[model samples]
Target: MKDKKKWIIGISACVLLMVSVFFVFNQGKSNEQVVTEYFELLKKKDYKQMYQMLNSKTVYTPTQKYFVEKYKEFYEEIDAKNIQIKILDEQDNVIEYLIYIDTLAGRITYRNKVGVKNEQIQFNKELIMDGYTDGCKIKITTYNPEKRGRILDRNGKVLAEDGKGYSVGLVKGKLNGENDYGQIAQYLETDVETLQKKMSASWINDDSFVPIKTVSEATKNDLINKNILGINGVKISTVSIRTYPYDKVASHIVGYVQNVNAEDLKKHKNEGYNSTSVIGRSGIEAAYEEKLRGITSGKIDLVDKNDKVIKELCHKEVKMSPQDITLTIDIDLQQSLYNEYQNDKSASVALNPKTGEVLALVSTPSYSNNDFVLGLSTDKWNALNNDVNQPLMSRYKQTYTPGSSMKPITAAIGLETKAIDPDKDLVAKDKWQKDSSWGNYYVTTLHAPSPNNLRNAITYSDNVYFARSALNIGKDNLFKYYKNLKIVEKIPFELALNKSQYINKNQKVSDQLIADSGYGQGQILMNPLQLASIYSAFVNNGSIYQPHIVQGQTKTWIKNVFSKETTKTIKEDLINVIVDENGTGHAIYHDHVILAGKTGTAEIKQSQSDTTGTELGWFTIMTTDEKQPILMTTVVEDVKNRGGSGYVVEHTKAPLDLYLSQVSD
Candidate 1:
């Protein structure tokens, strides 16, 4: 009887334990179901269903419409395209889940908590949405405009750098009284009337905060901290101002930045560029913009019911920092040239004859690059556009009559066609007699010496001698030589080059035209770059090196324009032009460095309205150092003097001296 009673007690105890286990298991399952449903609805963007799952007795009670909008805003704030969730753990009425968000910035993960009681769901609603919950809140913070890449010269000197600044703006409707204007003006260091005028720009409206001026980064902070500028209506924020440290020195090569316009936005929208972003407008800045622009990223916050942010989470930076660019330019050389010629309307280019590495490219009358950095004022814009000197124009792209500079090419052609002998003497006359077919055409001689050889002809720039050589070479051979030399051929430059035109094949070529062309007259127009490039052949062993401003040498050579023997002979003759007593460039000749080059004086016709004809004086000089050859070309415009090439040679000495003393080192 005792054994049977013990068995019955054991069986009843086991049954009670089983019933307790069943009830607890069902309760936990219910909690998990409600928690899972809440998150699943949130993932589906079914904010209404998610709101319904929330206990109505909750303290964080936002209306259904508000709940939906709040979630919508949260989705927008996160910039997320997708949301994924997984059950992490469950204990009685408490549940935890891992939420993964796929955003434009990157993936974001969160460990979220949910509670259940009496099978009713309860949680901090603001964790996924934004609004005031008793203990729940959401906050969004942005850490935008990370550091941008720098633009550096080949020597690693900074050319473009980020400068700390701030935009000072006023809320259109925030100014309550006249005293406000005075307070703001004092902080801005301006008069009240001027400040008012600036604030009242057309772009500003009653609800707008229009920026008036940019101040130093420190100044912006000081005003905000002291509230000295009447913060009630004033707006200030840290900003990155792209500054060209050298300003006007390398303006054309380094380029400038401007606010992105509608066109730029439309073009680069897919590249993540916005209307407010600054874009490279010209030069290297425009060319390498993709590598120079900065990437944007920000932070997001979760707020509690008391309007307090509970957590701050940052989004991963979408793009790496902009890469700094290293250019092949020598800034010191560039600046020196700018200093010497900034006031003039002329252009100069220096390059390595063998490799075609441009040492310096100067186009004078340059405006300050900073003028375009922040924004260009209308008055300044109008001035740049109206200035007759056309300061912005790069003279390398503009063609002008090359004058006697073409004599060397003619000499090369004469040598190639076997029309003239280097050792043979040719008679140079005072002037060419008018031909019956040429009508009034007459070619004058600048310098005349009897029994002039090829070397003497080039040394004295004997026009009649070259004219006779061109006639001897005949029209077809001369034309063929021009084609071989690529005189009017379109140059392959990273920068655009204007296509040069030769005498039209359809037009009749008279004897005078051929003679005039021989001495670089009568419709012979070539830019300074083109002439410099052709002249490089003399030092490059009769091979033309494509001219380039960037670092890597193209090493492009047009070979066999003249025989090695002929090239040697022609090169020596050009050397005589600088060293010879009768040479046009003899005025600036120096014994320290052996110089070889030619001088030109082209008579440029003025507008038909003006009677005074101007002369375009040109000189191309080169160092004879075989290992370190430097070639320089200079042109002076509108010279009204008979000194001609001689005057140019004298005036060009200072810059050349500077270059030799400084750049050679």
Candidate 2:
């Protein structure tokens, strides 16, 4: 009986619809006016008035609440408040109206029909809300977000940018059969079972629009060409994907963006973040998130009991666009450095000693930033995390023994303390013994050079000369000089910089241990960046400028840790290290530029008790070009019974050559 009644009501509704069509064709002034009133009510979102004007002759008419919800669902992406409707024609009481919907994606226009009779209106709601079922009426529309900011090098070369992409989603409960699912999978270039599994995890019901996967433009185009986007339950949306054009070239510096996780969503909820938001996870991306993230806006709709959108209450447009960020790094220089030392476990940092502007910093064994942005598979992510080389660790921040590099710092301390004269000969030998009060400790020289004054001491990297100088200057005075240079303190900068370690304040240090510190061994460890900044004082008239990686700006000078005269005297000694044939770094001398550098090799003991251990080669050089001066520190780790500080000088020459060529151009 119930089925029969429903059929009778359906038949009655069809008959009334036919009559309303005929009445609409008569073209009465009252009917035309009613159509105008219905659209006017729609513009004001006055669902109560719009529902009242619908023709009541139909036996299958929906309730007022459901009626409004259906309209809300139909115009989900549109700003109904700004929607403009105009009458195109009214030849037969049938009014053809044009609806203009302003959307973030673009402006959309479509035609809607209205039938009028006796000051009443009737229209097929199904035409506007396709595939809408009677029981489900809630609607949701995603607004377009502004593109993420571009990351550029100092020279305005794009390092990272937003690229066009697509996201595949499923409108739950809309699929008809296996054939429909298979067709969609085929278009996505995936098997039906794989696509089905993804949908199964995200699926809810007919009302849910669950995103299944993100695809490239090629996949989206393939699906579009196959006409699969029109398939029921399948949805496709264009998105802005974070793209790294240079890939892993500056991976550690530029970083990458990824979709917000549940933890981040909860933590950043107050900041207007959602599950769909993309955020910087590390490096420059994390350091300057506020400037890089784009504004997002969308419309909010209210639904009725039958899951229909009753009103589009508000529409918000993005207020701010993404801001472009420029880094001080030179990508060309950075890539050149990376390629030359990619095989070795090493790091190199190049900066303008005068301004403290970093030109390039390279840490080898880097992983691809693109992989992180696109989302890393578990296996790939694990491979990187578990790799022995620790590709993710930024060697720029890591600390290492300065080796004989500390000799320069010790020399400056000695000059300041009046412990050594610049021209005085030290008579360097192969070995020097510590005093009986300091225990049985003897310092050995790499190669003994006769008439070793401050100049030859630095040129030959003589261990005994520095050891004797450290004893003369005293530990208290040496520690004070290191503190004044801020060598062991955390550097002030945007990126994370680890602090160097010094001898424990309370620990008793014998004279021999203090002598070891002078030769760049023992307990002292120096961060590459901090060491570079301190070395800048040698070229910048004894004043250390704050180290920075952003272009077009100069960091403030911390202080003149060494006097101008002291630096001038020390610079001459440093210059001899490159010009003197007996110097360890003399092999790296170039005719186009004057090079002043120091080379040191410190043993990395496996344990405190293991005196025999692997060596770490260290080299710091200043390419003294009047127009563009570059100071760089290169360290080669785990050099076991192999080439010593010489290898460091070899690697340093490549970048110096590249940098000089660029400057010459």
Candidate 3:
């Protein structure tokens, strides 16, 4: 009985051992088979089968058709005939394979991962099954799409369009100097060195097919007749490159575009930007980037190893059409203002009095927008960036002491708070003595003998009168009224802005400081935009209108800050600043329209000299005939000849005359 039991145990042990060996052998064979299948599929140009053999769990299933379409579209053009595949790793649940495909077009490679599931491998079946559809064909043709858009003036007048001008771009890195660089450079009127540098710098390493140059006016005729082999790398792309027919006339206001950079890409990545694209970096281009970046559309074709057509994979239609924007700006007025400031370091801002629409914003020392359309050279970019006058900085963002421009705002505030009666007559102490110790500083008047009233005080910009008014009203009330008018604060324009600063009411407002603050001095700084908007409020009754550059219909109206009565009283007071005969801005005044305005000369202290640097300027105005009170401001920084007499009224008159003549007529 003992012998029989021992025999049974021995047999059971042997059976268990045989079963274990068979299981191990099968597992090894299964792994080897999967690795072999992966390589064989790749060797056969069966991408779909290979994809299926990969670990499916880690692979992402494209959630959208767009994502899959992009990958499939690119892979179809790739040649898999020379592809070499190797097994990189094999674990219980993970497998990795390395693929190397070689072709004259380019070397394509990738590491694919496959997840083992129930001992079965899964991959992209459709991709492998498509095989080499293009293997039978030899000729391959590549086609790029056309660029289309319109260029219009403030009033929809076409300036330059794809239909009118021809543009051609060369594949950035594709042009070879050893074979065709010298010939191409000669044909393009550029040197080989220059072309080489441009091509090298512009080519984004990842994608060499993208055209570097945004636009070049080389026609088909130019390319065909020149016998330029480099032309083979060129592709005809139709895009609208807007020119101001009068190039430099409105360059600053119209702004310009340059080839986008890393910084621009980082800032606008979500805005659908790619390298080799143009974006509005400044001026209207920057202000209207969203509206002007037209929708992009393209056709994606699927082809095989021999570049032969496969089934049409997918063709997506982009519907981002260019939008037309009509600005309140008058092109004629903008041009005329540009002409006036052609030779000076000057800036002017003109706004519609009633609606607060910016009609013209001009700055001199401008460059042609066309220069930027073509990428700017290193030297050209340096010249503009390093210029002492800072042509790149729009003066509207520049803040200066408003001088007497703040007088009207102060006066309006005084009347509203009842700090002073408008009709009261007061004698200007021609000389205001701060105290017994400070002695006396003489105040100048329109009439030397010194006649003083609210009208005469504003017309002459009487420091003494405003000084006493500020003292009586106090700084707390001073800032309150100024804040109400949106002075001493930002006006939320549709662009990046530098914040304006004003004295805190809680800070000390001594008699001398109060006197200086009253006449636009001591501690006050304002940008041209702030002054323009504030003056607009003073002119258009008391309602502060938010200034806007974009012209379009909207569902909401900006809130009104002042009552109707306050606006009426301020309008009457502001008119006296221009039309009172003794007014400081009288030089630019006209009765054809009920024009109201003010002039200022802020003193700037220089380190080199005892004499103060002066910013000569004038601001504010309301016109009745145009049914729009125009608020205009002009500033000429560092007038060399004017010592203390820098308050020359003519600087402001130039832009004002240009604006009124165009709009009033």
Candidate 4:
């Protein structure tokens, strides 16, 4: 009886175990459950886990490395973001789902199906629902790059243009490679080995641009000057690249271009910039980079193993064509001005006083901007950057004392405040001091008029007349007129200018400082741009035209900075400064063009008694003829031993003459 009871208990335990096994097999994960896990891994970009979930049964299965690389490369190139997946439907062992991916190129969305086999997902190259890159590669299709815009002058003279260059390279057809390698190396200034490897390129044809080293116009001239073109196989060819026609003539205004570096890549990430891309480095090129560069348009393609295009996966249509930029500058005037001051450390600004359009902006001792375009050699770059002359600096944007140029402005202020009576003589001496409080400090002048009235003061550039005027107007009222010139305020311009200031930091406050400033010396500063514009107020009926480099309508910046009476009186005084036989600037007087001008000299010294101080010479001139109106302000450093303000006047007359001859109604 005991043996029969034990045998029945064992059979009951076996029956319970069989029931549990059947229940577990029937409840195995459905297709939806398994595929959901696979997509969860996909959304995370967990390639390893996602690959592990893919079954090996499909012919479309790619190796783990290929899969990971494809996703990474394509996704990175597109700047993929915000991936999402949702189950759509299920049939048998297959599960259908919608996948959405956002990319820099655009958003991608599609419906895809996946198979679940034994709780594992089947691989489908078309899983993204876009045609799978199978037996094909991801191909990048780039359009003809937008032609970078040209920088043009008022008459459409091109200063900087795209798709033009002089490429100095070897001509395979002409290369007598045997005996000519040495001569070629010498002319190209490159070693023989580099040429050899470059020439040995399997695809080299007679017309190939072998070595294709682009050269600046200056460098091209150097090659000609050195007689380098006589060598066998050496040739210069026109190629597609950025070119500066005038080279250094407008370098400070046009700037240059350079290949994008790591810093630029970081700053412009996912903004269509790459390592090979070129960017504007300074000047108008940099200021209007977006407008000049336009939009980068291209497409992505899926190609077969043989490199034939299977289909286009993404396409970016061209939107904005590069726009040509037209400036108010007359290239001829710019060239003429640059040439006149090329050898000096000087800055010049020329403007249409009637319209306030900047005609020319010149900074002397300039370096060729084209050198940067073709890629500057380290030695050349270092030489330019480290040169004592600072050829790279834009001098017009820098500030300096206005010297006697401040006299007219000062007289205007005095007249506005009723501090000066034009008809009455102030009875000031050529050498003067306010009182015994001035101590040893005395204000002196080069010329003392018979009557120190307003007209004679301006005509002779009397320092004492304006120095006493500063004390009359007082500091509070003094800087008020200057403030209208944008002094202490940012000048609204495309390019930046260092702020003009008075009473510099840590400067000792005293009547001497104020008196000195009255004559345009004591810690006073103004850039060529501000001086030119303020001088415009003298001719513009006591108002200043807003300065602009672009061809735009004349906009009044500050209205009624001076009354018309003050401007009319000052205008006559300035005209006398140039017209009078005894005037200081009479040296530049023209018969046909009634030029009004002032000459000034700012003494730079370490101490009040320093006799060895340098002087910055200034000459500000403008046409009084309304039909052909132009204003030019010029300054040159270290003019003490060089003729003082007379030196600046002499140099400025050349460009002024050239412009007058070229002017039209």
Q: Which candidate comes out best when scored by TM-score?
A: 4
lDDT of 3 by residue, 156-188 (tens): 654333333345446654554346666665555
By TM-score rank, best first, the candidates go 4, 2, 1, 3
Q: Cα miss at 240, model 3 (Å)?
A: 5.9
Q: Write candidate 2's Cα lDDT for 306-402 as tens digits.
A: 6567655445566766778888888888988888778777888888888888888788778788777655555678899999999988887789988
Q: Scored by CA lDDT, what does every candidate get?
A: 0.74, 0.77, 0.61, 0.82
Taking the tens digit of each residue's C-alpha lDDT, what string does model 4 give over 97-202? 8878775555677778878889887777776437876566666645535578889999999988875668788888887754778766665556677778888899
lDDT of 1 by residue, 1-665 (tens): 99999999999999999999987776664777777777678777888887877777772655888777777766755666577778889887778888777754566677877788866677575356433344444454434355557878768888887886778877778777556877776676566787678766788778787776676555567877877564577887667788887877887777888888899867653345565678888877887776777555545666665646666554556465577877766777777767766776667777778877777777778877876765554567889999998878876667778888899988888888799897788766787754666555566786877677898888889988888888888889988877777767887665566755557557788777788888887667777777887788887778888887656656765777777676777778888898988778887788788888899988877542445778888889888777557787877687656467666677567767876886567
Order by lDDT, highest first: 4, 2, 1, 3
Model 1 TM-score relative to the real fold: 0.68
lDDT accuracy of residue 653 in candidate 2: 75
For all predicted structures, in order, the TM-scores are 0.68, 0.70, 0.65, 0.74
Off by over 4 Å in 1: 1-148, 171-209, 215-238, 294-321, 504-507, 606-611
Root-mean-square deviation (CA) per prediction: 15.3, 19.2, 12.4, 9.8
Candidate with top lDDT is 4
Worst 10 residues of 4 by lDDT: 137-146
Candidate achieving higher lDDT, 2 or 4? 4
